[model samples]
Target: MFDIARQHLKTPRDLLRFAMSRFTEAGLFFGHGTDNAWDEAAYLIAHTLHLPIDRFDALLDARLLPSELNDALDILERRVSERVPAAYLTREAWLAGHDFYIDERVIVPRSFIAELLPDGLSPWIEHPELVHRALDLCTGSGCLAILLADAYPDAEVDAVDLSTDALDVATLNIERYGLEQRVTPIESDLWAGVAGNRYDLIVSNPPYVDAESVAALPDEYLKEPELALGSGEDGLDATRAILEQATHFLNPFGVLVVEIGHNRDVLEALYPALTFTWLDTSGGDGFVFLLTREDLVTGGL
Candidate 1:
């Protein structure tokens, strides 16, 4: 297949078709930024050829230089043989039209909470300027922290993570966005590092993949750090801690939002007294939930 591609693949379109065929044949799992062979192939081809990913269709038939073809082929080969996600291969991931550096050091940033951040958590958050401080728990790569800084320009965001390696990557990304002053990366387990710090808003995309799901994850998912994916046997350890401790850190009238993957039912079943308001995202309402400080205090969960 390599020999045939080298001899016959001449244009971006050819590479696209070849990548699609190869990826399909390899049964590659896609979820980081794209979900299918065609999208993944186009992303890789565009990234390799130095073309805008969104402009891939415009250059499909354009001829590729020999060097360009070689680079594309190399990336495609790695995609199949290595089972690495395209985002990791390209060293970048996109969320809500924003791009951040990504690698094995941190899980690929795909938080549905990103969709709500751009709107400043509107309606719930009456005014963006009113938010003076925000917290991002389990903030791998500092993507959500950066977004929080952007959403509430006046707010100071503290991104907390347990892994030093993930904090290093988060620091790199924090510096990349020139947010050195507004976003601070903290190394601590959950809320321990930010004791006595009150915030107007708290958002988290913590480890929620259940034991069974983690055990059966695809090779691409296994490439990420297990500490960033698995929670507990039932996958609510992090969420449980967050809900229990958030009331202490939240200011009066503050809001708490969290993404729990597919554990909405399980979480609700566990905390039957709590009233969870699910937020709608591109995926659906079940993936993220919103609560107020009053709700947390009242539920006492």
Candidate 2:
């Protein structure tokens, strides 16, 4: 079947169509860098050709040589057989429209928190201008830290992660964006190595996937490091630690923002007294919550 399909795949558009069909037939997951088969197929086709993604309309009709067609088909076949994310296969991912170098060393950057960084945490932050220091916990690929640096140019951002491999990828991205002066990659388990530092804003997209959920995730997700995905039985082990210790690293008026994914109900039940101000993004509820230092001290443990 693939042989017949490959024979007809002579142009970029033809290859895209063939890939989308194969992806759907293989029941592939698309939540890493794209959400659907069409976009994912386009990404694979365009990136394989070394053409810009946005130029799809202009380049769709371009014919592919025999060798190029074989190479593209091979990648598409491996994507279906391996179940690895297209971003890992392509060695790139984008968050908030910003490009970053990615690999198996880190999880593909897909945090919804990226959508909320442009506004500078407004309404939740009374004085956005006063945000001089910010921290990104479990800063995979350093995408969030880079976004924070871009959003708040004057602020110094510290990105921490336990996995040295993931930190290496983050360092590459930090350097790629020319943000070494503003963003520093620190090797630490949460906040252990960065003690005594206070920040006006603390953000995290920690490993909140529970053990059961982690085990049940698609093969594409399994390609990422399990240390960056699972937290404990309830998936709140890392988040619980962050909530307990975040206040110590926060200034008087500091605020904490975190993305717990679908674990919001568990988190809310765990701490019913604390009012978690969930933020809304383009992708609906977002499952991200904001809390002030006062809220953490007075309401949260």
lDDT at 89 for candidate 2? 89
Q: Of the candidates shown, which would achieve the greatest lDDT relative to the real structure?
A: 1
lDDT per model vs. reference:
0.92, 0.89
Model 1 agreement with the true structure over 171-213: per-residue lDDT tens digits = 9999999999999999999989999999999999999999999
How well does each candidate superpose onto the true structure, as a TM-score?
A: 0.98, 0.96
Per-residue lDDT value at 170 in model 1? 95
Q: Which regions in candidate 2 have their CA more than 4 angstroms from the true location?
A: 1-6, 126-128
Model 1 bad stretches (over 4 Å): 118-120
TM-score for candidate 1, residues paired by index: 0.98
Model 2: lDDT to the true structure: 0.89
Per-residue lDDT tens digits for candidate 2, residues 59-95, read 8888899888888888888899999899898898888
- Pairs that collide in candidate 1 are none
